[model samples]
Target: MSLLDADAHTAHIFTGAWTRSGGGDAPVVSPSTGTVLGRTGIADADDVREAAARADKARHAWAAASFEERAAVLRRAGDLLQAHEAEITDWLRRESGAAAGMAGFQVHVAAEECFEAAALASQPHGEVLRTAKPRLSFSRQVPVGVVGVIAPFNVPLILGIRSVAPALAVGNAVILKPDPRTAVCGGAVLAEVFHRAGVPEGVFQVLPGGVAAGEALVADPHVRVISFTGSTAAGRRVGEAAARHLKRAHLELGGNSPLVVLDDADVEAAASIGAWGSFLHQGQICMTTGRHLVHASLADAYVERLAAKAEALVVGSTEEDGAALGPVIDAGQRDKIHRLVTAGVDAGAELRAGGTFEGLYYRPTVLDRVTPTTPPFAEEVFGPVAPVVRFSTLDELVELAGSTEYGLSLGVITTNPMRGLEIADRIPSGIVHINDQTVDDEAVAPFGGVGHSGTGSRFGGTRANLEAFTETQWVTMRADPARYPF
Candidate 1:
């Protein structure tokens, strides 16, 4: 299908029903080629309220349904996802400018989350506690109410599905406000799967729109909990809105993650892993490592190796094979990255290699002599750029790594296991990886950050998301009121 043709179509699903949005449409473009893939609506505040109310109404029946019933629906959704994996991957590649392999990986991850939620739903929410007085107390996990999810453009499907599946499996209706840039690939496809899975109307709603829609969703009293994955600034806004309603808010914000290389480390392996981790999705991921803290002893050699690897990376369109990295989401993001890199150069940091920007394509960048004063080191550079900072001692390195406001994820590469463990303990990040980069995420492991990174965990095989979307109720009965009188 033609890119313009795709852009003109809208895939809207609400309450198990499908329709297109009635409003001015925003074009979704490929970051690699600047080609329009599809257009989604810039939904108004009223439309967002309607979507939230629909979910609020559907929550009653959905929450009251049996666990088995919910599990069946999620499992069927998983099946539909698998059957349409190729098409979904194509859409992601076109809309997000994601490499084919990366797009496929995201689809697989989302599908796996569906199955994980299904399996988890059958498990017990609590265990009965026996007491001497024969007073029965058992905690039962229940849905909190309508959940509001705001997903980012990068990794839209993976993150969205991760949050949505668990929320639905736990019996809460969901309202998803996808990144306007990738709604067609992320929210639209998800709506299709939910509809085919026979989900009840209003149980799952995908609102494709802009900031106004997001503000409306978060501010709505009907939305009991808000789960947002985006920039630190946006996350703060969402949290504040949730606070107004005294609602629970889950924020997965931006990261300036650090990769520490100890003196006794494998420089080559670290460089390769860092290259992939930093450049994947053009460095758009929240957990992507943005800083490289190398022991001063090995700083020179490490930069040389890292620079060579980064230069060797194939920067091209997602459709091309052997392309390690693609373009940024758009000209705006591209320009932002350029300004940050330029500022870093002006701040006296040496531009080691790969500082090329043509349209949306930004060549992977590696800078040296970056200190806390440099914008590239202090701010979250959400592009294919890496800043190398040299530290002399372990204490200095630890202090430097912990200086950032974000405590999302950290990576340490060293041959000494004891030293690696010691550094991991000192890092303030929520997740610490030894001998690898920060991009290595496991489906079964608890994944999230601390401080400004995020508020809650995403994975870990635990029902964390389910618990976040649920509340506890206490019930009591007294055989002898006089014995237990206050």
Candidate 2:
């Protein structure tokens, strides 16, 4: 059956088999038209505990499965994702306000995530250690039992799948709690994929719920690890809760990332990169270019060009109008975006292009003459508002870019790539790009940030995934059993 079809066998809370949620139904409302697209079951705290118990019960057998078996399942899941790309993209566009291009990107990356995770299943899990005595000693990675993955509404599929695929491939069972707002695309689609890919019963579950469910997942004794992707405020709470439970929490949190256009860079090309960095997916990305630091010589031209690009972008409903940009996730986010823009303008930043909205369709806004003190300039606006400021020297540029609490992604446009690297060396970001935009991701690349942006451990790539999902155990063996003396 199609994954989107609402049925008892494809409900919101899936534990071994699909089942109705304990919490009441939650409506999936379309951002564009304010229409109720559908309704799915909502999971409460009790349901989260139940899911965790089931996942923990099934984890040992899953961990004992042959490496080939785990790899096969992940590989099949990647293939299935490509097969249902169209349907999944449609769901993302309708439910999460993802633009057509953004939705396709999510599907593509999510498939690659599965493929990369598949490769991880067969990689060497441990290293041999030298021992002075007549004994063999080695450390091997092992599953940490059940993992809880809490995902956000924006970029729902990729964020959730990145953690889910790796945890499952590394032999840990997963209980995914996608944001209730994006339950269908983030939760239901994944449940269908794993179920069809021959994952064992009780090994994976998708519980779509609100704060209570998320809190329960963290507190559940059976869930030993949590991979959470969301706002920094919420991530801190999750981290604190996970620490209280002694569970490992891998957090990919919020960012107010910067894109620096060096003095010698081509103004037109830099503007193009800046526009895409700040406006793609309506700038709802954690790695979106929230601050644009342009060298003083090129600042004026850069602002003009950026404003022009912002004006040209068609902001409307992706599903209905085939717009280049879509709405902010919902009304609350829309209000936040506008409020930040207004505050910036009032605080002395000049509105260069946008600053208006029609219904939920917010125009791509450019705020020039923006100071560090300007609203949204130093904050994670998480909207399509680009604030451009000038830097007179390399020291000023470095200081400006590194000022924010977030250290996620950094982009630099420069004539000399080495010069860009030198600047990046002084910054605290986890990911950096020369002559590229701030928002970029690869399934095989280590993806995460530093400081408030994320935990130090990354989510993607082989080494990172293995470390994130598995625990290392040191084993020592002698020719004969050694006796311990009191």
Q: Per-residue CA lDDT of candidate 1, range 1-486, in tens?
A: 222233324544343555556446787777767776656766678877888888888899988998899899999988888888888888887788898888999888888888888877777776676655656766777788888889999899988888888889888999888888888777888887876787798999888878888888888988988888899899998899889889988888889999988888877888888887788889999989899999998889989998998888888888666677877888888888999999999999999888887778899999999999999998998999999999998889888999989999888888887788788898888888888898855556677888889885754466665567678765554566536456
**Tens digit of lDDT per residue, candidate 2, span 123-205?**
99999999998899999999999999999999999999999999999899999998888888998899989989999999989
Clashing pairs in 1: 7-38, 7-39, 15-201, 15-202, 445-460, 446-460
lDDT of 2: 0.91
> For every model shown, what is its TM-score relative to the native structure?
0.94, 0.98
> Highest lDDT: which candidate?
2
Error of 1 at 72 (Å): 1.7
Pairs of colliding residues, candidate 2: none
RMSD to native for every prediction?
A: 2.6, 1.2
Model 1 ranges off by over 4 Å: 1-15, 130-134, 458-460, 478-486
lDDT of 2 at 205: 91
